[model samples]
Target: MSSSDIFIGEIIGTAVLILLGGGVVAAVVLKRSKAQNAGWLAITFGWGFAVLTAVYMTGSLSGAHLNPAVTLGIAIKDGEWGNVPVYFAGQLLGAMIGAALVWVAYYGQFHAHLTDREIVGDPADKAIEGPHDTKNTAGPVLGVFSTGPEIRNVWQNLATEILGTLVLVLAVLTQGLNDSGKGLGVVGGLMVAFVVVSVGLSLGGPTGYAINPARDLGPRIVHALLPLPNKGGSDWGYAWIPVVGPLIGGALAAGIYNIAFA
Candidate 1:
């Protein structure tokens, strides 16, 4: 594929990924919806299917590294460094557009439902009265954009994200695209899906297993800009962990793969 074709394919592939992966979250979390609170199993399957479809469509042209961390990992494994910026930018931009589409797809429901202020029982008090109360106002918006643990703290949350993403990237490096005697093909996509499921089942309760910076940050930005009944703060406090954790995990996985093979 030409450079332009690869770039366009990456954008389209990432958009499809976020549309399905992130869209499922919006479906389950937003109020009065069909899939509300459906639990981790549903999310795991949704993401798995999303990745499966994306890979089938664009894996040949762009390798379908929808996550920036995955792209970085591939770059470490002999992928051209010059294409790094193009792929990363395409993924992020596609994620943002996909997230915006999700919001648009669910706009009617978001606007018709109760606002965050009302959910917090302040209806009158726009300011969050307490941390616990903050959830009532923030839950709907943040819930759709990213995952937060039931327990809140920076270090623990960060640890969960790092550990989860490390497991995910490690799986990707070893089982995803290697020159094993058994070669990777259709099963590789299935393996990727299973990795996401494992993360969701085990560590998803904490930090919502964002693992992908574009997945969280792109949607969060949309949640801030879009008109909803009641939106809360962007929850920037824990944003760094999702970004840093996945990058670290991807790099760690690549390093481990290099060492094990060498």
Candidate 2:
């Protein structure tokens, strides 16, 4: 495929990824919304569908590495070292743009559903309510790109994200190796869906399994820009966990695959 073709595919694929992945979070977490508190099932299915759409759209050209972590992992495994930076930049840029679009699409809801006071919150209460209550609205408003533990400490939260991403990437590699040329046309999609479902069902409650960096950072920039009620966008203390966790997990998965199959 031409470079331009791959670039366009990456853009479109990443946009779809953010839309569906972030969109689901908005549906489930937004106030007085239809899907609020719809639980892990909805999130998992939403993400699974997002992956399916992205892969179908860009897999032929760009391999649909919507997640930078995934791109990095693939480069490590296949020695596509020169293309790593280009892919990473494309993924990040696409992610940010996609996240901005999500904020725009949900603009009306954000204003109508929440008040400015809620976004900023009271300084005194910030310490207490910031982490807990923030999850309810912050994730949907900013971007569904990161993960954090509901009540656990930072270490546990980070661990949860890492482990979740590990499972996700491992599943992807396993399916790619075992199902290739076996008529598993859509099995990759199904595998992704099942892996996400497993994580959400079992491990989501702790950290909202943000196994992807672009998913979080891109939307976060949007959240900071978009005007919404009571939006604090405090960067959630240490925002790096989502990015680092996923990378760690992706690399670990690649290494494990190499050891086992190579």
Q: For model 1, which pairs clash?
A: none
TM-score of the candidate numbered 1?
0.86
Q: Give the residue spans of candidate 2 off by over 4 A.
A: 116-140, 143-145, 177-185
Per-residue lDDT over 9-91 for candidate 1, one digit per residue giving the tens place of the 0 to 100 score: 67887788788887787777666778888976888788878878876777766667778777777677664577778777878
Which residue runs does candidate 1 get wrong by more than 4 Å? 116-136, 178-185
Model 1 accuracy (lDDT, Cα): 0.71
Q: Whole-model Cα lDDT per candidate? A: 0.71, 0.68
Question: lDDT by residue for model 2 over 36-99, one digit each (tens)?
Answer: 8897688888887887787777776676767777766666666666666656677777877777
How far is 120's C-alpha from truth in model 2 (Å)? 7.9
In terms of lDDT, the poorest run of 10 residues in model 1 is 121-130
TM-score of model 2 vs. true structure: 0.83
